[model samples]
Every structure is written in structure tokens, then in C-alpha cells.
Target: MTPNAIAEHFDTTRQAVSKHLRILTECELVTQKQQGREIYYQLEIDKMKEIDKWLEQFRKIWETRFNQLDNLLATIKNKKNE
Candidate 1:
């Protein structure tokens, strides 16, 4: 979609949408092509997959930490009841 369409959908200004689009384009997460006077932007699926993989690694780390916290909380509760 064009920046104007995205701006309208988000109820934001076209300039703001254009700035966000530029950032995404720099990250290679989104690509833009010129079609006559308008620029069309499309999502880069491979870049999205790479991001998903990176986030998944962090999710596992957080899950392990949460499990440890839960165990510590249980132990504290048991000690208080003793």
C-alpha cells in the first residue's frame, strides 16, 4: 500500500507514515517500488521470518526465567507457612 493509504487507515499524517516507511525500508523489512507517480510498499517475508526467529530465541530465555521465578515464589510461600 501507499503511504497515503496507510496514513488514512491509521488516522495519521502522510508525513509520519512516510518516515515510518523509510525506517522499515532501511531495515529491509519493507520494500518500495515506484509505479508511475506513486510508490507501492510491500512486506519482505524473509526479513519477517528472520525477526520471528530472533524473537523466538528471546522468548525461550524469558520462559526459563519465569519458570525459575515461579519456583522461587513457591519456595518462599512454603517457608512462610512452616
Candidate 2:
């Protein structure tokens, strides 16, 4: 999407959107192609998928810890009632 379009969707200024796109381009998460007077941006989906998979590992650990905390709290509540 053009920076103008992105800014409209994000409710931000086009200059702000362009700045973010520039950072993404530098990080290699987005690629920019020039066609005549237009600059088009494309996301690197494979990079996104890799990041998602990496974060999922931590998500699983957090889920397990939260489940254990819930169990512990329930046990304490039951003991207080006994």
C-alpha cells in the first residue's frame, strides 16, 4: 500500500507511515519497489511466520504457568473454606 493509503487506515499522517515503512525496509521486513513515480511496499511473509513461530514457544510456557497459577489459587480458596 502507498503511504497515503496506510496513513488513512491507521489514522496517522502519511509522513509517519512513511517513516515506519522506512524502518521496516531497513529491518528487511518490508521491501520497496519503484514503478515509475510510485513506490510499492511488500511484506516478507516468511519473516512474519518465523517470528510468530518463535513467539509461540514462549506463549506455550506462559499458558502452562498461568494454568498452574489458577490451580494454586483454587486450591487455596478451597482450603480456606474447609
Q: Whose lDDT is greatest here?
A: 1
Which candidate should be chosen as best, given TM-score against the real structure?
1
Tens digit of per-residue lDDT, candidate 2, span 1-82: 7777678898788899999999999988899988888888999999889889989999999999999999999999999999
lDDT measured at residue 19 in model 2 versus the true structure, 0 to 100: 95
CA displacement after TM-score superposition, residue 49 of candidate 2 (Å): 1.0
Which sections of candidate 1 miss by over 4 Å? 65-82
Query: What shift in Å separates residue 81 of candidate 1 from its native position after superposition?
Result: 13
| Tens digit per residue, CA lDDT, model 1, 1-82 | 9998888889778999999999999999999999999999999999999999989989999999999999999999999999
Model 1 has a clash total of 0
Clashes of each: 0, 0
Once model 2 is optimally superposed onto the true structure by TM-score, how far is the C-alpha of residue 43 displaced, in angstroms? 1.0
Error of 1 at 19 (Å): 0.4
| lDDT by candidate, in order shown | 0.96, 0.91
